[model samples]
Target: MNQPTKKVLSLFSGCGGMDLGFEGGFSVHKANLNPIANFGWIEGPTDSEQVLLKKNRFETVFANDINPDAQTAWTHFFKKSFGYSPTTFRLESVVDIVKRHKAGENILPKNVDVVTGGFPCQDFSLSGKRNGLNSHKDHTGKIIGDEDIPSIETRGQLYCWMKEVIEICQPKVFVAENVKGLVNLGDVKDIIQKDFSATSNDGYLVVSPQVLAAWKFGIPQNRERVIFIGFKRSALTPEALEALSMEDIPKEFDPYPKATHTKPVKKDVPEELSETKLSDILSDLPEPDGVTDLSHRHYSKAKFMGKHCQGQGEISLNGISPTIRAEHHGNIEFRRLNAHNGGKNIKELQAGKPQRRLSLRECARIQTFPDDFEFVIPATGKTRKRWDLSPSQGYKVIGNAVPPFLAYHIARNLEEKWNLFFK
Candidate 1:
């Protein structure tokens, strides 16, 4: 039997959400059940703690981060969990990685089957400044530092960097994910086609962009993102492209699967039959204290004090959560039970008032993170106390991630295509 092809890499990997979804293709032990496994190697730097908590085992290679604070947190977590440092992981900036690779100092490994990433999307987000190819803000919204501002050639050019990495790595298949707004960026579609056309690699065909909803997959959020898949021109046969061109790819991709649970718009429906609600994701979560003073120089742990814990009006367990936002605080507060209420839980609380804001754990749950996944907190001596994770950071990470279930479906489809093409 021929050896099975193995190896995968991810870029701009935030909290390993995309990596987890793609890894679902391989059989993994999940709470006593073994699911199909997919990843053999994973890379990227953000949220390494969450990735380390996963039961799946694979060679983790090539994690990178530009932020020193993020790098420090990642290293601390890796040391605490794995007892050693990761090989091939770098604390260097991504631009430096590209430059080194371009200089022929770092050659990517061969026969890598897949490359995936959720590149920074602020420049391309419809909800953002609409700067298109000239945004000066980084993904995190800080004004571009005086020293880091880009020239016209590099402004809003991160997508071009992704394209460069793909060209250099030459993976059999690549998946680039971004906000749905990426499709509308000034002449982006034409630019992508033009860029791909310029490559000499044969049979490389970019799949039409797919707008996928997280709820359709198993995630309990209504996030939508655009996914672009490309097969090396050499990997696709002439017949496949001919067939794809003839058959309208978008038509086949439409009518995406429906959410397993749908949220109810009215309170008249029976509570038992209502779709999933915020309470379902947060009922077991501890309450949050209103404490917000902490030094930014070091990680600090905060105690979870029972402040508010009630669900806003009637909620369903079957539907998706409202979109989590970083800046939403007052109106968007998730409802929590009033302490004065005799009821012990949110469901028993009186209806009609706005719910308390969602806790970080609840946000994580809604984002489809496993209940046991650990978020890094400040450590005191040897014990790491559970500080109330920052709601803003949680919101940013959750808001930015591609729903794992959506990624799973996309990966599964691509895997099928790989088998068919390589057979």
Candidate 2:
């Protein structure tokens, strides 16, 4: 009998974007469907329950986070709601978790085929300090913003920890997702190359980096992320690699995905591909409210208005939505309507009213989350309503997540090779 399809173990599995992408497959349009079943996941931070619900993509065998609050949220949601009590590892860092597994302190599920993650990008981000690996001292020395090493403190060396996990797990295929800046970091690339070389100390080869845009794969967002794929030598034949390199590899595999959507303007095309406009992404959401306070009274008034008003546009009524951002809660740009024209003034445009920011639901939609997925907001003051998380946090999460559709394409392209050569 043929062996069961490869099992997956996801690391830094933020809301399971990479996991979902590999599981659902990718498409150029909404009509196309490709689904891969039989995968499991592990995510850090206990607070990922909302993220998991939003993606609603894969089964999780392991979930871990250093934050007690995040773990609490996960246990409450997954265990209490679905009776799926994921192995919860608290106190231990990701590296510690990997080490424990390696030393046989904890047992991994059977037949883990692929390991994936979008590791922390703070140190490698343009907005963050440019400290690469050498920042470890600063991180450990309790140096203000640099202390927390791989977890909350210094994220510079987080990739190193991820590499350790890959080394210890030794899965057949390992996939890493990170900000595009990672490829630009000379030291980061060097470290990856070195670790990859060591991982393949035998004869296996590692392919070059591939940067992909979500838009080209059918999602409406314009997010770009870099992917590093390492295949084990023992899992592949020379002929298979040759076949993969020549025949089936995607056309725009080097620096970006091919542009499936284009604009008439030349300035629009960067090294990354472009797709559906903001109008295309959010045309379906309702108009923003014109209030500006933290009071539930204000929010209630706005909600009442929204419910009664005809609203400008039709509800999206589709599965896809634009990527959500944390800034949506307070930013004028995020609140602005998608009209190609009209609305001369801020007031006319509904720019910064009280409830002007995108709701958590709207933010989730923008990030391409399914409608039924939920986020837990704490109830505050006289308003028993849970206070939605900061729009900035939403932005960070969505901006950093791998677009599932795009990931699906890469996985589909690689699936045959995974089955024939790796298996």
- Highest-scoring model, TM-score: 1
Summarize candidate 2's per-residue lDDT along 1-423 as a digit string, tens digits. 543555566666554446556654211222211111212221222242222311222344554444333343344445544465556324345666766777877555555566676766655665457565545432223344444444433446655666666566666766777776777888677576567646733433456767666555546554567778777666666655664455345443321234345432588564233344444444444543442322211211122123223232222323333333222223312233333422223443555423233454444444555433334335456875454433334344444556555666566555534445553
**TM-score for all models, in order of appearance:** 0.68, 0.65
Could you list the CA RMSD of all candidates, in the order they appear?
8.3, 9.5
What stretches of model 2 exceed 4 Å from their correct place? 1-3, 25-60, 63-84, 88-92, 136-154, 200-204, 243-274, 287-332, 337-355, 377-396
lDDT of 1: 0.51
lDDT of 1 by residue, 1-423 (tens): 543544666676655557656655222112111112223222222232222222222223445544333344334434544443644346554555677787888545555667776767777776677666676755333468657656433436666666766777777777778777877776875676566545454535675667776654445555778777666767655655554444365433321232333335577744433343444444544444443322211221322233353223222333456654433333233434354522234443544333344555556566665444344344456555443344344445555556554565566555545544432
Model 1 misplaced regions, further than 4 Å:
1-5, 25-60, 67-89, 138-155, 237-239, 250-318, 326-348, 351-355, 380-395
**Where's the lowest-lDDT run of ten residues in candidate 1?**
27-36
